[model samples]
Structure formats: structure tokens, C-alpha cells
Target: MIENPGILFSVLAFLCAIGPLVFIHEMGHYTAGRFFGIKADAFSIGFGREIAGWTDRLGTRWKIGWLPLGGYVKFAGDMNPAGVPDAAWLALPAAERERTFQAKPLWQRAIVVAAGPFVNLALAVLILAGFAYAYGVDRTPPVIDQVAAGTPAAAAGLAPGDRIVAIDGVAMATFSDLAKFALIRPGQAVAVTVQRDDRRQAMPLTIGTVRQRDRFGNEYRIGRLGIAGGKPVYAPVSLIEAPLAGVRATAEIVSGTVETLGQIISGRRSIDELGGPIRIAKVSGEQMSLGWPAFVWLLALLSINLGFINLLPVPLLDGGHLLFYAVEAVRRRPLEPQAQEWAFRGGLAAVLLLMLVVTFNDLGAVGVWQRLAGLIG
Candidate 1:
């Protein structure tokens, strides 16, 4: 049994958030292909039966799909939506072949395939920049409001009304800078500099570590000084600075994701943090509840992830197509059709397997099995 309203909202929010992004991504390929004289057979935003459709003058069938999760643009000379070519495509009239995706020059094909991910990247950057420009960055000085008694802050003589000037010798531009600096170096001593009553003071403090777990069951230790944050003040940004700040923030997010993946690969981080469509829907709903800005932020982040993941050299993905093109370029001919077929099959299997694992992780995060076990117990 499922909760109607909750599940409905989650599904709806997930669709609303994902549908446009997927369409935009596919359009990147479609538009590029069209620009290079590569004809599109169909442009469908979703899978399965068409909800609504119209045939364009260009002989392309454009339609909405019943499923709102993802979409694709089937190109001329393509065997399938995944852009694999077939013998029939090569047997087409010479003039028609010129407009088919497979008949395009290697460089053109590369551009068309790469366009999807590149468009996603551009969308994220643009969204971030637009939001930052409209609502300048939230700035709050790292001022301690209340120092918890018996905590490391109190032990270090940190008092209320004191402002954190720096942590670990790094300038604390905002309270987040301090928290990030402390959290990453749990159980480590950090050099703290504070501004007290117009006087600057430097003190050494050992950060206390506290074990914390998220709803996903991933546990980690974070350094805590037990100081409550003060009120935030939004700093207005100049038109020129907003986009630049957005770029910086986007870069930081990409870098952080890379670092996290690296840690997980090295076994320094848990694979349990990996999530799939379920997790995404849950997060999307939660973010939607938080408000539009936050939801948009999630969209931007997801866009970045989509772009990044699609750029990976995995089969059945845009990155995989790029990889194939690279090899073809080097060899002055394409890979054997049988070899490409096997590669696609393997890639499809791998993608589905990965999705299954992430969905299981999502179920675990939701505590479905835990509840069943509790009932049995």
C-alpha cells in the first residue's frame, strides 16, 4: 500500500523537474544534427505511446510521450534511438543518405553527440548565473550566538558575541567557510582567530568529533565546536559579479562531486550514498517543498550530473558515442558492426545493473526493509 498524496506529489515533482531537462538535452542533439544537415526521423519527449504529436514539414514526427522520465531524438540513418546505424540506412537513396546521421562526416557526428551534454552544462551555468544575479549570495558573518556549555567552543573559551575571524589560519569569509573547515578535519586541532571587542585574538582549539548519520544510513564524523550561527544577511551583488560567483559555485560543486567519487572508489567513502531515480524523486519533492529557488538549485545540480555522466565513456550514453567516434577517427573507419552491437549490449546491461543497485540503495534509504523486519520481529 502506498500513500496517495505523498507518492503522487513526489512523482509529479519528479516529472516536472526532469521532463524539461531531458527535452532540453535531446534537443541539443536534434538542433545540432539539423544544423549539420543530419535529418531527424522523430523527436519524442518520453517513451512509449504518444500523448500528442504532429508531423513537421521536414518529415520529422514530433511528439510527447506518456512516460515523463526521459526522451530521445531518432535520427535518419539510425537503427534505433540510441543512434546505432543499420544496413537499411546505408541502402537509402544517396541524397537521403546525405541527410542521415550515419552519412554525416565524423566531425559532424561528434558535434551532434557531444551537443547534448554540452547543452546540459550550459543550462546549469545559465540557471546558476541567472539565480545569483536575481538574488545575490546569502552572506552571514561567522558570529557565534550561543556557545554550548561543556562543548569544545566553551572549553576553548569561546564566548557569545565573539566573531570568528578565521579558522585553521584560513580567512572565514562566511560562517559556511568556518563550518566546512571544521567539519572536514574532525578530531583535529585548528588555529582559531576571533575578533572580540575590537581586539583580534588567536587561539588553538581541538575540534570535538560527533558521529552523525543521514536518512540514507551513511555515517560520518564531523568536527563540532557547538556554536550556534547568527542571522544571515544577503549581500547584494553587482551584475558583473553574480555570474562569476555562480561559475565559482558550479566549479566547486563539480570538484566536490569528483572528490567524493574518488573517495568512494578508494573505499574511503561508502557506496551506499549512490542513489537512483527514486532518490532523485524524493529529493525533488523535498526541494519543491522548500521553495522554487531551492528546487531550481537541485535542477541545476542534476543538470550538471547529467552532463558529467553523459560525458563518461560508457556505452549507450552520449559519452559512449563520443568514445566510439574518437576510435573511428583514429582508425579512419568505424568499428565493426558486430563489435558495436556487442558494445551496446554490454553497455545497456551495465547501465541497467547500476540502476538496479542504486534503486536498492534508495529502498534502503527509505527504510522499506527495516520496517518489514520490524514487523516480523
Candidate 2:
């Protein structure tokens, strides 16, 4: 029933985009397992039916699956369903059990599980560095690019030709600086300085409240300044500088993600804005049509996200398992079987709930909900 080329392209893009990243992520586990003297039974990319596969001398089956959503690495003597406890594994004798993930030292297991996310983070940094190196950084100068007619800026006598010299007598070096003055402190009246034909003029301006939409259909409040500023051009720098640029961008992205999460928790952000697989497909398809640069940028951003999500302290996640292992290490014993089972059930429920929420948000954003409502109307 998939007729649209855009949908098809989106599917392909999702596979192409997520497959390598997932493969690399799982590979991190596989390689770390090997390093920790654990034996991997199977390494698969994607899920469900195996489309193609080959086995290595070590008896590890490398495979491509029909469902390209995600992937996994199965280590020998591990519990079924990954990281579970197995009676057979326990019965397999100490030497064999040592190959199990739980049987290894806590530090070793943590490294193996943590490697996937770590690789993703590293890839993000590298991609960011590469991007900064290719394109010189851009910043908006304090000069107004355009002013909306009848808006606050225009009403306050701000003009397109005006160059912002300062705000409240604080010398403004760039247009972005002036913008931040408006954005972070919305609804506050502030003094503005401008250069009019070599003469400095001052005026009072107030920030306006605006609605911003996320990947999901929900909206959030942001400060709006009705003027545009031109980005100051910076020449591309040396390789060294490129990595520094990468660090700056990546740090900002991480910080933004954290801040957004905090806002959502505090009710300042809407949960309806959460995106799911459908949204990702749409984005992937759109990016593919846009060009490779945009696609690559999305990939890097998603990679960083994937890395961050995996590190959350939730059961069934890498971080969660690492946390349990840390506790086990500290206690010198594993947690009770019932406790582990309960933790897993809770984790599974949380994940399913998240999935449902995101699916609903995606459907709404894609106009499915709106179309149905229109039909009813």
C-alpha cells in the first residue's frame, strides 16, 4: 500500500541513516565484548527476518535483517532477551559463565554496554568538526536586515538601514547579541541604540512573546524580535579550530537537549511535541530531497540524540544496566531475581508508553488527526 515515492524514499533514508549508526553502535558492544574475553554468538543489523548473512571463523553470524529499525549483538552465555540471567549459562561452569555479560567484572560490562553510545557521541563531534571546517562560522551583525511594518520594532522607529550600536548603552557587537537581549528576557522594555547616517540614536524597545513549534505539533513560548540581522562572515579556520567549533556546537546541542527536557518536565514545554518513527521517516525523506549536506547534518544530530537517550538512567537501557551493575559491584552481589524482573517490567512499560505518546504526536502532526476531524465535521 506504500505508493508515494516520498514515503518510499523516507523508508530508504531511515534505513540508510539508522542502519550504519546502529551497526556501529552494536559493533561497539561486539568489539568490547571480544576485548573483555566474551564470545559473541551473533551480530545482526536490523531486526526480524534475516535477509542476508555470513558467519565468521569465530562462529559469529553477521546478518542483515528485513526490518531495518535497529540491531543487536548477542554474547555467549548471556540470558535470553539480552542481559538476562540464564540457568543454563550458570550451569555452564565458571569458565563458560565468565563469558556472560553479567559474569564479567562490572567495569568490563559497563564499558561494553557504554561503548555504543560513546561511539555515537564521538561521531557527532567528528561530523560537527568537519562541518565547521567546511563552512566558516556565521554570526548576525548588529545591523538590521529587515524590519516588519507595524510591528514593535517598526513602531519604535527601527528601520532596515539602522545599525544596532547598543542596547541600554551596553555596546552590541553583533545582531545575534541584540537578539539574545530580546529573546531571553521577553516582555521587558529595554533601550536600544542605533547609528543613523553616522549619528547615534537611542530608542526603547520591548520584546514580544511568540509561539514556536517543535517536531511535534505542540507549541511553546519564545521571545520574538520582528527584525532580521545579517550573520557576520567568518573565514574557515585550520583543522584544529574546526574541532573546537565542533565541541562548541555539540556542547550547545547537548545543553539545549537537556534544557528542553527540563522544560518538558516542568510543564513549560509540551509533551505533544514528541516525535516518533513516522516523524523521523518524514524528516529523513525531506532531508534526502534537500541534499546530502542537510542529510548528513540530520544524521549527526540524531547520532548525538541517540547517544544521549541511551545514557538515561532507565532500566533496560545501557545506562540502566550499568547502574544496576554498579550497585551489584558495590554490594558484592547481584540484585534479587524478582527485583530485576520488576525493574525490567517497569522499564518496558515506560518505553511502550513513550512509544504510544510519540506515535500519537506524529499522527497528529502529519494531519491524520486533523483530516479525521474535518471528515467528522
Candidate 3:
């Protein structure tokens, strides 16, 4: 048995979580480019100096780099991983230019770039489908199992057998919907409709608010009706329906992420909730300890987030490349080389800055900085 198993588990779990997703993303670019008859000069996992590499018959260099956080595909005629064209590319012979990525038709380029994020989404759907096919999902129905005394549910005359049908006229499908509805509207008044003995009745109730603390001592305010769900029911779904369920599940994650981001941006939520690599690693280990199934679910969620982030219209990302192509199509020409260079530089700076900030937050969350400060003191 290993001492400090949590540290070991976190490291391994983080790698397992990131490795497959990165490969899927980069392989998407490589596969799509080759399919379009564009030659790939190199494909690498990670950045910096190459640790190991091999060249194939097609002259594509496949390599693993020192860093393992992400990867990229270098299409022929690209100056770097950003897919910018070089002077050598522009001066190539006509036949050679044909094999280069930039020389391809606009639609093909877009497909090659968009393929990475698309594969990520597809991978998420497939992973989720597999899980659904195997064990289905555990869910709590809208029927109230317990109404805590002195809470909104008890005051509103909600009983143990009552089934919540709607909140403010919005039909709720599950117990989760009830929680979701109340959590964001702390201290607000809302009408909840319930079905009892096949008769529906609406009850106006005030959402109770409470300050909750995490193990890390971070505080948050949330609303509650103070009702608990009964035992979770696991529905065994067929394979055919699994993929459809996967689609729905993936969409829910995306929508929830977008909503959270919107809340943070609108100042309705705190930015402190944003996490980085360390937080992910910690969560990965915690999930792995739960079960392999839970770990797989974490990977699926991470895959979806990877796809979403890469699709942002910021330079140095797949979405940024697509943005450039869109502008080219509209303006009937590519942006000036200098302009493109400066844009990529700015994007790199922005990405690096974000990484630094997130890393700092992670350090703070894990008490690394505080511990060091104590030592110094």
C-alpha cells in the first residue's frame, strides 16, 4: 500500500482524464486534414521539446512532447501550431501548395479546424452513452419524501407524499429541477404546484436562505424549500435510447456551464468558483475513489468543457482559426501577415495570463501558498 494515496491517485487520475481527451482533439485535426488530401507535417502531444517521435511513410512526424497538458497537429505549410502560413508555404511549387492546408478550399479548412471540437463533443456523447447503456442513471423523482420542520416546505403545507409538478408554472420533471429553480432565487417568493391524490394545488412559498460552508471554509448563500427526495431510482435504458440520452446529458452540461458563466459575468455568482488544473486533479482523484463509473462521468464532463473552451473565438484556439477564415471569406482576402502575427501574440499572452491566475487560485485553494507563508513567517 502506498502512503499518501490521495496524492498518487490525483496525479494518475489527472493524467487519465487529460490524455484521452487531448488525443481525441488532436487526432480529429490529423484525420480530417488527411481525409481532405492535405499532408500533415507533424502531430505532437504536448508542447516544448519533443521527448519521443517517429516519422511515418507519409513523412508526418508523430511525437510526444515534454508537457502533457495539450497537443496540436501541424498541417503542411503551417508556420507553427497556430496554422499560420509561412513565406516558404507561399513560395512552394504549385503541386506542393496543393498538399498544404492553406491551399485547400475554404470549406475544407473550416472542416479541418472544426473537426477537433466536434470529435470532443462526439467523444463525450459516446462515453455518456456507454455509461447509460451499462448502468443507466440514478435519479430522484419530484415526489417529496421528507419536509423538514421549520422550513418552507413544512410552512407551505407540503407533505411527504406530495409531488411537485411545477414551479411558477414551469413544469418540473425531476427533483433536481426543484432545487435548480430555488437555488438561484434565494429569499424570493414563488408558487409551487403539487399533485396530491391526483388533484393539483398551487401553494405560494418563500424560498428560505442559508449560508453554507464547504470543507475549505468557503461560504455560499443558497435557497431551499427544505424537502428531501426518496431513494434514487435507477432506470435501465436500452442501447438505442442511450445515445439520445447522451445527447440530452451533454446538452445539459453545456447549458449549465454557460449559465454559470453568465451568472459570474452578470455578477450574480462569484468568480471564486472558477477552478484550474489543481482543482481538477483533486476532483478527479475524489471521483476515482467513488468508482470507475464516476471517473468516466468526470472524463465525459471534462471532454465537453475542453470542446467548449476550444470553440471560443479567441486567438490561439481552434475557434480563433475559424474566426480568421470567416473574416477571410467575408473580406475576400486574408488578414495581413503582420496583423495575424500580432493577433496570435495577443492571444498567447491572454491564454498565459489566464493560466497564471488559475494556477494561483489553485495554489491558494490547496493551501500551498498559505503553507509557504507560514513557513516564511
Candidate 4:
């Protein structure tokens, strides 16, 4: 029997973390649709059987479901949560079609579809900005204070007192910037520019890779540059500056995600590194145990990731809808309904495959496969 309080807490924390994010994402779609005079049939916080629900004056059924995995806003004419237009509704009289999502102008429909992911992105930015305003921004200079022997820094002939000014021609304004750039590019070669005394020189080196475990025993393989920087420094950010700081932080996260995905696509990184709901739940619980601050930070990070993922050009995702809209705009007509149906089917299969792969990776991460092997042996 599982008796660990921590395990239970992790499950609760996972719900606490994901539930609101999903609600907010669905709310974004709901609100945007309403703004354009489109009627929604349902605003559901999960899929499958309804746990509880009530109908609002607008006749929208607001409900919670047992699954708690994700949520969706079902527009008046949607055939399902994926928002495919119902052929029956499409054939309805023009007067009845006015309030349907399909009846909206192309631009309005695009906005409604795009709003969900953009709202997630905006939420992340706001949360980060709040943090910056409450605390401050890191202002540590990118000067190398020590270069560990036999490491990448040493191999590249980098020395103490050399200041990192750029990596691959991109400016590094702070030590944090340097770390962020290198962290996602494990074992990747890069050109590092540094200023030693009065002369600036560029050196080529491969970032070292290291396997490390977090406090909760979660393992990660990350880039390591075996160099130390000077003492930490932080500067207070004003309310006006906080938003900018948040934007910069969000941009960094986006770039890092893109870089990591690119590496994974190119087979430079192991597929095992990909994580799913299980990994997220584990991390969420760990972060919650740390403190509210840590948990909140994780929330913001995950929110940004949620937003970014929805923007990808995959069918059944917000991006996929946008892609169809883009094609519709260019073609001066919608694609054949048959083609769209097939595309959605393909997308659904791809999405399901991804979920399975990530879940398998998550199981491996939690030692489920190892335990099964031991039992079999």
C-alpha cells in the first residue's frame, strides 16, 4: 500500500497546478468568442462525463468533468471540443447562423482561436513581472572569476578576469544570460567571445554535458561550462521596468524551448528527455514542497510552455486551426471538408502518439519499467 504523504501531496499539487491553467486557457477562448457575439454551448473544465454543472443566463453550460486533464470551450456550432463545425449547423438558416462560431468573419474567428494561447503567454508575463516588481532583477556581470581545470573553459583557454561579451555573436549582458545560452546546448560547439584586459578574442569550444539530480531525485542531463562568475548582484526594478524584465525573461524561455526542441528533432538530444503529465506532476509537487514562491515560478514557466506549444503548427491544436484559417485566407475559400477531416484525424493520431511516447518516458523517469523488470526477474 502507498502510505507516503508526499505522494498524495504530489497528486493534489498536480491538480492545483494544472487545473487553473487549463481553466484560464479555455476562458480565453470563451471570452474572445463572446466578445465577437458568438454563443458558446459549453464551457467545460474537463472532458468525459460531467461531475457538476450549471447553465448560465446565456445558456452556456459551465461544467466540471472527472478527467481533470484539460478543458475546452464548445462554441455553438462546434461538433466536438476540437471545434470542428457541425455540418447540420452549417446548413441552418442565415439568421440562426449569426451566433455560430463558423459565421464570424475570418479575422474574428482567427482572433478567437489565437486568444487562448496568447492569453496563456500574457499570464506568464504578468506573473513574471509581479515577481520582478516584488523582488528585483539579476544584474550579475558576465565576468569569469575562475576556470576549472580540464573543463571546457580551460580547454578553450579561457581564464579568470576574462569577461564574456558574446556567444555566437549574440550579446551576453549578464552571467545568467551566459548560463541560459549554454544550458540548452549540451555538448554543442559554440563560438565564445570574451574581453581579456584590452583585447577581445573569440574561442571555439563544446559545452560539457553533466547528469544531475534534483532534490526530488529527478535526473536531468544539462550543459555545463565549469566556470565560476563573480559575486551575485541584483537591482531593483520599477513597476514600469518590471514588465520589460518579464518580457525579456519570457523571451529567454521561448528561445530556450525552441533550441531544445530543435536539438531533439535533430537527434542531438535523447528522446528520454521529453516529459509529460507525470513528470509535470512530480515537479509540481516538488516545487510546492519548496515554497509558494517556487510553485508560482513553476506555474509561470508552465504557462509559457503551454502557450508556446499551442502555437505550434500541429492539427487539433490552436496552431492547427490558425493554419487552416491562413490557408482559407490565401485560397479565397476553405479547404474541402473531407481534406480537413482527414487532416484532423492525422493530427489526432500524431497527438496521441506524442502523448504515449512522453508517458513512456515519464514511466522510465519514475523507474516504473525498472520495477516491472525486477518483478519479472
Q: Please give the lDDT score for candidate 4.
A: 0.89
Alpha-carbon runs more than 4 Å astray in model 2: 1-5, 80-86, 139-223
Report the error of model 4 at residue 105, Å. Answer: 0.4
Using TM-score as the measure, the top candidate is: 4
Q: Please list all clashing residue pairs in model 3, or write none if there are none.
A: none
Candidate 2 lDDT score at position 227: 93
TM-score of 3: 0.86
Clashing pairs in 1: none
Per-prediction backbone clash count: 0, 5, 0, 0
Estimate the TM-score of every prediction: 0.79, 0.80, 0.86, 0.96
Ranking by TM-score: 4, 3, 2, 1
lDDT by residue for model 3 over 120-141, one digit each (tens)? 9999999988888888765679
Q: lDDT order of candidates, best first?
A: 4, 3, 1, 2
lDDT of 4 at 129: 95
In the range 1-377, model 2's lDDT, one tens digit per residue, is: 22233667888888778888898789888989999888898999988999999999988999989877678898887665436576776688887777777677778888999999998888898898998888876555678888987677987899887998887777777676676556544565878888988798788888677877744233556666689876566667689898887877787688668867876787756788678888888777777766788889999988988888888988977888878888888998878877887897898899889999999998986789999999999
Model 3 is weakest, by summed lDDT over 10 consecutive residues, at 1-10
lDDT of 4 by residue, 31-142 (tens): 9999999999999997899999999999999999998888989888886444546768778788868899988989999999999999899999999999999989999999
TM-score of 4: 0.96
Model 1 scores a TM of 0.79
Lowest-sum lDDT 10-residue window in model 1: 1-10
Model 3 CA deviation exceeding 4 Å by range:
1-4, 80-86, 138-140, 152-162, 166-170, 180-224
| lDDT accuracy of residue 134 in candidate 4 | 93
lDDT of 3 at 152: 92
- What RMSD value applies to candidate 4? 2.2
